[model samples]
Target: MKTIIKYMLLCLLAVNTVTAQQNSQSINLSNAEVTPYEIELTQNKTTHILFPSSIEYVDLGSSEIIANKVEATSNVLRLKTVKEDISPTNFTVITNDGKYFSFNVSYKGQPIQLSYDLTKFEKQKSKKQSEVLFKDLGSISPSLVDLLMKAIIKKNKKELNIKSKTYGVEAWLKSIYIQDGKLYFHISISNKSNLPYEVDYISFKIKDRRTTKRTTIQEVSLKPIRSYITSQKINSHSKQDTVFMLDQFTLSDKQVLSIEVNEKTGVRSQVLKLRSSEILKLRRVELLKL
Candidate 1:
């Protein structure tokens, strides 16, 4: 009976050794050594963490805290502790650009800072992406979209002749590009007047082809998802270039697309009417590099 007990003990020791070895091997094999950022949370106030890209997912290690992405914004996360004197916890955030972020959170009566902008940190800048598609981009890689946008700006080709000229200010549609269910509009504004053309705003909308004085005009607005423009002021005898990205769409008959640019605090507004035929003139996106 004593020999049998000794044999059982030896078997158990061997099993424990194997399990420990497996665990050590798994821990050592890593893609990257990601150090978790330490942050303190409190119940009295909320903490905000700003990411470079839209947040895709968030997971908390414990229920001691509540966290969520801020409404009406894609890149800001709001967090707060549930109660006072809670135990420490950890959380993970995955962003649309396929970057992973880890945080170790501890409760503090008063946190030193409430807002953290990760975008400003050089270490937090967007690098290589993981294999994930952005929801807004619809199965398209966010990195690819960014690369294409940069490529378009670098190319800067004036391939289209569509324009609306008035008030000594001319707005031209330099190009229209299509890729991955998106439309890229390259535009240029030339101001020939002696005064600078302060652009108030630009609008792309679909409206009825003909509106009667007695009837209400039906309209639909098309807001761009992103844009690449530094300034809106077109100085006298100068020009400015811009690019806008929007979801691809097709209009029906009796509907015309309008691209309107309004002057700031002025009445010089130019509208370019586009028919379905004109909008169909799309340049397929095929760039080797960004």
Candidate 2:
């Protein structure tokens, strides 16, 4: 029985090895090349290929318009991009095999020599970390907050305080920490108000630049505090204070977080702002934890 079990286990292991090899072969490329912002790959066998979900291609020249075109087949992946209405820039393409391809652009119907180096591109790409932080909130100003509050109140479609909405709130991100590859945003909410109010939910309006669509990325609702006092004075004077903490929040490249508060009484809402250094600090902390 022991001998039979051993033989069966060996057979299973062999089968698993074969399966893994086959799976790897599906995406194997034969000859791969990378230019500064471009990549070309050829496959050894006819296998279905998928384009990369995200890619950043940089142009060396000063051009207002740049476009990228990608094509993938069973055995090849090709990417091409050109600057419009400007002289072409000299650039390099680096291949995965430690090889570089150099190409130059045409300027005024003249060929300009451009030297391409794969190592340089790799260095440039690696120097900049692709991470998002809370410092991004600083761009939210008083005027923008007013506009967003007006929009949200309009969405609610209620007859609320139009005159008492004299107060404004802002958020300053102090620090961001990352642990285990997850992001932790530390922010301080500044409220400029004479009357006390309860904030029900904090809504974040995230804009998708690629699609030009606005979507709410996060809606953090405050845990309601129960009270026995039911008098109007008690309700109106009740001050709500709390810090929000979120775990495992992930950010995509070029994504920004716009925070807004939804109040139960005394004006409708407030907006928060974050900064860039705070974001980088958070990313560094998170990376260290991981």
Candidate 3:
């Protein structure tokens, strides 16, 4: 009876091992069929590939027949081939999330696997000129950059005698500058009180003086040009400076653009105001050449 019980246990163990091996083989076959990206291109034709997200980086195995090495728009890549080559080529694109999308360019005839939406592609192309201008502004001096900052502060002081708010921390409106149809604000935050201040985040909104509800107003969001600091932890008796940029557009007299700063502790907030007059004053700044 004991020998029969041992034989039954061995049979069960062998059946389990066989099932596990079969599952492993199925998984391997499925993985073999999955690919990053695959498409065929003609020997002397142009091909464009559109990606889901904006491309952050790109790499090419060789630049022999690639007419345009790696010209990438926000979510589009343009590859042109002039002649056929001996060795194969691999093209890879790194998206914002760091995921790699690779492709192999096999020299073939017509009936390629390339498709794109022309309306969306043209819109992405329009941003190329503005993107180049933003990069050039980074090389300018902060002091010279401060001219725009001073302009914004001066507008606030002249129009409204309102001073900056000070809870445990104090914020000052430094300057407002415009470059290549983009609005930018420079500000300084100081914490001299005993309590430490943790920044929650900064937000921009346009409010209508005639209406009380802010949601009714239409405004495009603004972002920091260079991500120098997002939400810094501010210790007591310390100060820091930051800059922000908004989409280029003019506001009417009835509209007011507000920059709101929220604290993590929910104790206090500083709201900076920019009216049409202030924006117009910034337009006349020397460097802007409005």
* Candidate achieving the largest TM-score: 1
lDDT of candidate 1 over 1-290, digit per residue (tens): 99999999999999999999999888553656577789999999999999877798999999999998899888999999889989989999988666778899999999999999888763655443334565667876766777677777678877777888988989888778988789998888889999999989889999999878998999999998767666878889998888788999998788888999899998878888888887888788874244
lDDT of 2 by residue, 42-154 (tens): 12212121221122232334342232333432212232233323545554332212133344543332222122233344356653212222222233332332233233222
Which residue pairs of candidate 1 clash? Answer: none
Q: Candidate 3: where is the Cα deviation over 4 Å?
A: 1-55, 58-163, 212-220, 223-227, 283-290
Could you tell me which residue pairs clash in candidate 3? 148-175, 148-176, 149-174, 149-175, 150-175
What TM-score, to 2 decimals, does candidate 1 have? 0.65
Maximum-lDDT candidate = 1
RMSD of each: 6.8, 21.5, 20.9
TM-score of each: 0.65, 0.28, 0.44
Q: What is the Cα-based lDDT of residue 128 in candidate 3?
A: 18
* Runs in model 1 lying further than 4 Å from the true structure: 1-36, 43-48, 53-83, 92-100, 109-115, 121-131, 165-169, 190-201, 210-218, 229-240, 251-255, 262-266, 287-289
lDDT of 1 at 122: 34
What's the ranking of the predictions by TM-score, best on top? 1, 3, 2
Clash count, candidate 1:
0
